[model samples]
Target: MNRAWRTVFIALLTAGVVGSAAWLVFVSPVLGVREVRVVGNLDVSAGQIRQATGVADGKPLATVDAAEIEDRVARIRRIESVRVSRGWPGTLMIEVVERTPVAVLPVGGTFALVDRHGVVIEIKGVVPPALPVLRLDRPGPGDPATAAALAVVGALPEELSSRVAEVHAPSAETVSLRLRDGRSVVWGGSDRAADKARVLVTLLKRPADTYDVSSPDVVTVK
Candidate 1:
């Protein structure tokens, strides 16, 4: 019995030493990230992402929390979604999904980049020439006005999208369109959005200055 107890104690002591050594030598260093890989980024540079992430070359790979990296990267306004992962002993991988500018919103005198869902992603110095502006009052997330704006965006005809100057949501139920050609499209409300769009498209093909599609079936252009 004494011999058996001595053997067990020695085995336990040996395991503890081996575990500590492995943790100290292998796991501790791997806790810091040594390499970083950025993917799915455009307009924003890899260097910029790396800097924003604050993940340096010496960070322990195993110690790096994927959620922490994701949160850090997501702090940048242009990034919509991010994923972070560590590869084996030394590599840190970052995958980011960038937000594409869909429209511009008036921010005081300047403009802000709005996504297709009407999310104001970034405040910018100048509005991009290609994207149209969305003129809307401040609406919180999931507000009816925001829903109406998104509806109008979805209802817009592709042919007219480029020529649109702004989408005006003056009220929750009403939307008006300002065209690049100095014309207005009066869309009375969110009701029958697709119907209004179809009628508007047909009338746009004609030589008209102003269109009123408030009543979808009986649209008029002058």
Candidate 2:
């Protein structure tokens, strides 16, 4: 008799638990998102994010597609990666990873923001502060020269790079550097970038007028 009673109690308890879960999932629907929180956004604005998602407060939380939101965010240039999550009970979260702009090049009258990957990310209203101005005649979306330029920039010594205000690849025959300190560096080609960096460092110690590392082993002092 006691065994039968215990089994009945267990069945009742199971039913109650299932009913409560169903109520919470179907009737209550407390998992609906009410807000979206964004983080790590420097390029894309919150308004832009909301506009891209077409999701707003009061939208059904259960239907918030994180992957869809991420796809929309990816369409926006300068946003390298995006992640979305459901913040239960009233919030949807969108985290975006923005591509870092490495330099600014004058495309037309305005400046183009270029990333390390050599992709032009944006054209700003005004030139950003303290970024290198690349002046390659053939710097376009299709030019491998742009990638080479970025690689050269990446390889340059900090002291030399910070002193540089502009870089010019006149015809790919030579890569030139114009420094803020009234100096120039003739980095001939990208073949010996590290060696060129070292040579430039040594040349900088005395300061003639310019240091030519086009042939790093056989440097020219001007």
Q: What is the C-alpha lDDT of each candidate?
A: 0.79, 0.79
Model 1 / residue 38 / CA error / Å:
0.7
What TM-score does candidate 2 get on C-alpha atoms?
Answer: 0.73
In model 2, the worst 10-residue window by lDDT is 25-34
Candidate 2 on 81-158: residue-level lDDT in tens? 888887667788888888887788897889998987777898987778667899887887667666667777878777
RMSD (Å) per prediction? 3.9, 3.9
Query: What's the residue-level lDDT of 29 in candidate 2?
Result: 43
> Per-residue lDDT of 1-222 in model 1, one digit per residue for the tens?
599999999999999999987786446764556778899998788998888787667655656678987998898878889998777667788899998877777878888777766667878898788887777677545667766776777667788778888888878777888899989998888788888887888888889788999898888888
Please report the candidate that would top TM-score against the real structure: 1
